[model samples]
Target: MTSKNLLTALLPLVSDLSRELPERERYRRLLEAMRALLPCDAAALLRLDGEWLVPLAVDGLSDDTLGRRFKVSEHPRFEVLLRSPEPTRFASDSALPDPYDGLIEGFHHHLEVHDCLGCPLFIDERPWGLLTLDALDPLRFDSIELDALQAFASLAAATVNVADRIERLALRAEDEHQRAEVYRQASGQQSKELIGQSKPHKRLVEEINLVGGSDLTVLITGQTGVGKELVAQAIHAASPRAHKPMISLNCAALPDALVESELFGHVRGAFTGALSDRRGKFELADGGTLFLDEVGELSLTVQAKLLRVLQSGQLQRLGSDQEHQVDVRLIAATNRDLAEEVRSGRYRADFYHRLSVYPLQVPPLRERGKDVLLLSGYFLEQNRSHMGLGSLRLSADAQAALLAYDWPGNVRELEHLIGRSALKALGQHRERPRILTLSAADLDLPSPSTAQENPASQLQTASSVAVAVGDLRQATDRYQRQIIEACLTRHQQNWAGAARELGLDRANLSRLARRLGLK
Candidate 1:
């Protein structure tokens, strides 16, 4: 290409960097321009994320390639790109496997590339990532202008820095708004003191006291609706950063596509329907605490990015390249067995280890015993206040029902039940009663003694039932799954405990659970 034509092609990219386009779009156009200058069949821009190269933009790779995280230790070609200061090319028959093998457009399952060229990108003399170009023609880049490619790479780096700065400015305002909202939420939750005098409750409080003073990451594990979020609030209230806001996000509540953007913020137009740049929970919780509920539900891709932020306290927004330092004490909660998830390759082991630095298992309601009455009273009062009644109390039969029935749904269920029963009891009276009283009939609990029996009531019933000859295998599998799942729940999803109870190896049980889809 002539110098005049090269300048004309480069002018468009230069003008785009200054335009109000999304960081992702800017990178996409930049990658396209680099390909135009070098004339390659494929081109991609990857950002350095610790030991991994995360694809930011690609012009000729599979759609899944954008979501794939490449570890440098696993891909030698990526390491070569990082080590070299200038542009580097590889031999057509090089033994090193290509990272984009079979992913390059129009290259139908091709494992070997005819020609490959890569230029490392740097900002302020620090290695950022690399820009790569690939072609099927053996001599496609044999005589390309190395200096011109280097100049374009420099321009790309400058564009990334500028976009990053612009995004930071937009995120600042959003972060302040989030901080205020969290403060309001924390204020409302301040009076919700943990209510229980049981041994398990006492032990939990002691554990919280010991761990709260430190800056370690916390993983609160329990069944769904078991007040795991309450425990998180207690920890944050006792921590040094308690004065600052405590931001919370439910990983399971969001779709896989938005999890990363919600946790790490995103620039305007980063993806479809992103009309404006928004700050993520991590940035909003800077200098405070971040509580991630149902964290095990996060996809492996988002888990990898989360691990990076926890380890380094630095994060780049979804579309921006600028890394911002945040000081956040993370508190994560999940009902699922993350260890089992890791064993089954559903969750990353490294991220699991990082999050479980201080593990706290919240006791289920069945184990809390008499604490049920105390919580019943609390919820009764809450309903009374909302209904503008003078007071509310439970009848003797209702108290027995509350204690006898095992709360599979935990605290949340208890709260809802009380509210529902109060309305039902009140509606039964023609005139306003002096003090609304909820009875066993009003509570209407299911088999008050079922769940508290052996944790295997359902499984035992299944095993006793007769099955046809051909359906025996299916029935037996269901029985086994029930037994294993019951044991896991009885042991708080502890593999070692479950293994001991079931007389099976821990690894073997994990493998079985995976096969049974229990994980």
Candidate 2:
């Protein structure tokens, strides 16, 4: 690359520093400029969050690449680049396994031998992240001028610094720093983040940011397995009370008798099972946020009690006359249509009104377009790490199957499918392969036509069994047994997948299976 061409690429980034651009766009243009100057097959800009290198933007890599988190310890090339002061280019035959193996866009094969070049971006003498370039040819950067690349690295650092400054100015400096620290801690613990680039996901994020700083009661409504709980975590993480506890309670997981006690605590003698005085989710989350999953499952009586606390900011423990004052920000999520429940007199209208003060509707997975590929990548990486595999990826046909099928069970279903597919695919090989590629056959998702036919086929089977069973109760039990058996067989006896397929909670499905003598 000529110095003149390098200057041309750097100039655009330098000018972009002053232009107000979205953080993702700025980094995207930076990678675009890098590729233009160096003429590499792929380039990525990653931010160092604790021990993980998170892709902020990418060019010439798969869309799912953005969702992956690369640990510096696992990738030797990344470790060397971060430790070095200047740009480092690995030799073509370098023994270090390429992290980008099977990840380059339009490349279906593992990158056995390829050129890799990277430079660490530093801000205020502290390493911020990395700028990396890769090429299919071995000597792509051998004749390239190192000084030009070094100069461009400095420009990249400036671009990142500008983006950080703009964001800090938008939010409180201390709060933003705290949030970043929380994210770093979460990264170190391998916490799953809400990862996506679709417009719907972006909109949901925007809404989270908009309402997160306040103490608004946010009601998140979505289909089951659509990640409503993750959304609640994100809101709490972004809130002013992030340093405090964010307690969670799943209303549906508990019985009606226990829901009230869980929400408002219970004295030692409150009920037969109440052995000791304990704090409730509200008191436990004092000065923080309280997330109620499946809030719609709460009975009308409990809903009225919950509304009183929301209105008065005080709660009385079960069997206790004294009321306890507590401050808590409420964030509730439900897959049910609470408004319909209220109309049906099953849910309290006033409590429903209070909870919907800020309603956020999480979009289902099918509407997210190609985001399935990105999510698949995230799950694949997780399974790869768990299985101690070099790399795990989806083939073109697997990607097509993921996109074609309607994600009736949403993100949870996708996550389970990917993990199952990876394990099944691995078992097919006598020896472990360096790159485990999941084909459409391994995924085992029904074709669009087959999926359409399944419901009708199931109904037909149910009708045939109804004639053999004498009573309505007997017929219902027989139908349920058949459906559960079919789902279990389809998912290879994976209870989680079977539960998701039947649109029932795993625990509930297990209980039903046991009752039906199928367990």
Best by TM-score: 2
Q: Pairing residues by index, what is the TM-score of model 2?
A: 0.83
For residue 299, give model 1's deviation from the true position in Å.
0.6
TM-score of 1: 0.52
Deviation in angstroms for 156 in model 2?
0.8
Those runs of model 1 whose alpha carbons end farther than 4 Å from true positions after fitting are: 1-190, 446-519
**For model 1, what is the C-alpha lDDT against the true structure?**
0.79
Residue 490 lDDT, candidate 1, scale 0-100:
64
Candidate 2 per-residue lDDT over residues 301-395, each given as its tens digit: 88889999999999999999989999999999999999999899898889999999999999888767677888887888788888888888877
Give the per-residue lDDT of model 1 (tens digit) for 1-519: 678867977899889877898777888889888877888888999888566676778897644356455657767888988999998889998877676655565444334547888989998899989899988887898778888888888898988877767765854423433444455466664234577766678889888867877899999999988899989988886676767988999988999998898899999988998889899999999999999999988988888889899989999988898898999999999999999999999999999999999999998887776778767756765576577554466655676688777688988899899999999899998987545667799999753544334547765666565344347667777777877877677667767656755667879999988988898
Model 2: lDDT of residue 358: 98
Residue pairs clashing in model 2 are none
Error of 1 at 191 (Å): 2.5
Consecutive 10-residue window with the lowest summed lDDT within model 2 = 446-455
What are the lDDT figures for the candidates, one per model? 0.79, 0.85
